[model samples]
Target chain A: MRNIIVTGGSRGLGLGIAERLATDGFQVIAIARSQTEVFDAAAQRVKAAGRGALQFHAADLADIEAIPALVKAIRKEFGALYGLVNNAGLGTGGLLSGMNDAAMAQLLRLNIHSPIALTKYVTRTMMTQKGGRIVNISSIVASNGFNALSVYSATKAALVGFTKSLARELGPLEITVNAVAPGFVDTELTSGLGEAGYDKIVRRSALRRMAEVEDVGSAVAFLFSDGARNITGTVVTVDAGNTA
Target chain B: MTSRMADNTEPSVRSTILDEIHRIAALHNKQLAPLTDALPLMESGLDSLCVAVLVASLDDALELDPFAEDENLAFPVTLGDFIQLYENAAA
Candidate 1:
């Protein structure tokens, strides 16, 4: 009954990870604002696997103020969390000159600030417990820049930096903090890009296709597994050789 | 959900909060569609963090605590709903 929290678990990569973790026999507490569908899906997967219970929590990650309270609630309900997956993020795209200052600010708040706050809160609990795994869902754009993805990339880059630094800070406590930088996964976010746009992205990848959400999930699960206990402060790129 | 308070239309308090919401929402590329009532907040693409940013911006502009309690607050799905919330707080 190891407790885990997967933020943005309503769909896409987060839901994929939640489903896999549930099947692996870990009690999963999913966090999302409108995640009823995600919960139903994850529950069915868990039941089919005949392992672990699933709990869904609804919260807006954009509300940075609500994060500490949310973490506290999880601690109260589940005791001590064994793993945390900071997969909740938002995408905002526009030319730099045309983008408004407030949009940039909000993007940073959701993509960077929320994850940092959650990591800070959860790290404290993990410190006291003397064991935990943290996997941050970063973007491939963090390494390779794109035209309209400046703000989004910046936030994810900050996340990668945070992951490395926090790993150092918490490694002595036996808590591993790492990041999974996925390249163009098939999800709601990509669906919004439409067929032509998606094809362009896929062709740019070395594999000539988009990585499935579960591909990223398997990488995240590996990082959280006992075999990865010695791996920390690293960015595992599950980009299907896109960076190579 | 029209009210005498919302209709008062003074730049004093309520209007300032409404203006801030519109400004923030627009910055997020959200449509201020149907600046009237009856929009669900969760569907507007304005998540919890947007609300916090809106509150902070409102605090800076209006210098008040319109976001006093979370219990009484409703997620604003539309421009009108946000304006109504601001008006209720002002009242």
Candidate 2:
């Protein structure tokens, strides 16, 4: 079976992507800080598909020094890897003047730096195998300048830029690289927005509603499928036409 | 960059890439380190922005894209492999 790794897989969009791939016939390695109910729900999805298995590894993706060793362990256990979803990220909000260097540093490290480092190692192995896929979970905030999200937007924008170029570099190997930019989904990350804030976002969207987690997960699953062979270096936004 | 390939082209290209590498490393605030063929490019302390710039510069200068055709290429891990990639493309 093909092996795939999903960072931030315990909850949010990462769990959705992991479960979707599992049901679609790929073994998934879920990495997150801790196990969650969503992770167990992912297992049920895998079982419903009648094939593939789910494994969880709890790690702080922010602790990037351990990534190489994590990759080695995954290789020893699952053999060859064909997919990687760099979905691990944190959202920070504050006025530019109020934001401290430490907060900016943490946001940059987790959102932008760690994924690229992980991708570097994973891409090397994929090259040896002659093919693979990489999908980065970017945010619509990267494109639209959201209030109080200046630093967060900057980091996400960087990820989008990296995805576009790396796709070109890896195209020769049939290893596609892409990013999925989701707008407001009803995930825990957005819960802090409160009901009024949530409704305001939904009204702004052309579709008049926030997206379900499945919408973004399905997009990720499509990128990994055979039909998406020619798609690369682009962002698939799954925000109910919110960005439109 | 407009110069034609010549006997001196390889060395000039190598040094130019080296200069760009140093520029990028410093831009990212990474500690200056020695550049050697065996030094891992990622671990050389260049971040994604730095690596992306270096790769794009090589593409513009060399103009031989191994990824453009049916050519099969391995991912370059070290400085040597990256330079060798352009060298192989040139050949």
- Interface DockQ per candidate: 0.02, 0.04
lDDT of 2 by residue, B10-78 (tens): 545676677767765654467755788998987887765456656644544554445433336666899
Candidate 1 residue lDDT tens string, A36-114 = 7556966887887788777788889888888868887887888778999999888888888999999999999989999
Best by TM-score: 2
How many clashing pairs per prediction, in order? 6, 0
Cα lDDT of candidate 1 equals 0.78
lDDT of 1 by residue, B1-91 (tens): 1123556764656556556657767655666544445656555555554555565555445544444456576456666667666666667
Candidate 1 residue runs with Cα over 4 Å from true position? B1-91
What TM-score does candidate 2 reach? 0.73
Shift in Å, residue A154, candidate 2: 0.7
**lDDT values, one for every candidate:** 0.78, 0.82
lDDT of 1 at A224: 78
lDDT of 2 by residue, A139-171 (tens): 999899888889999998999999999998888
Which runs of model 2 end up more than 4 angstroms from their true locations? B1-91
Q: Model 1: which residue pairs collide?
A: A62-B49, A63-B48, A63-B49, B40-B77, B41-B76, B41-B77
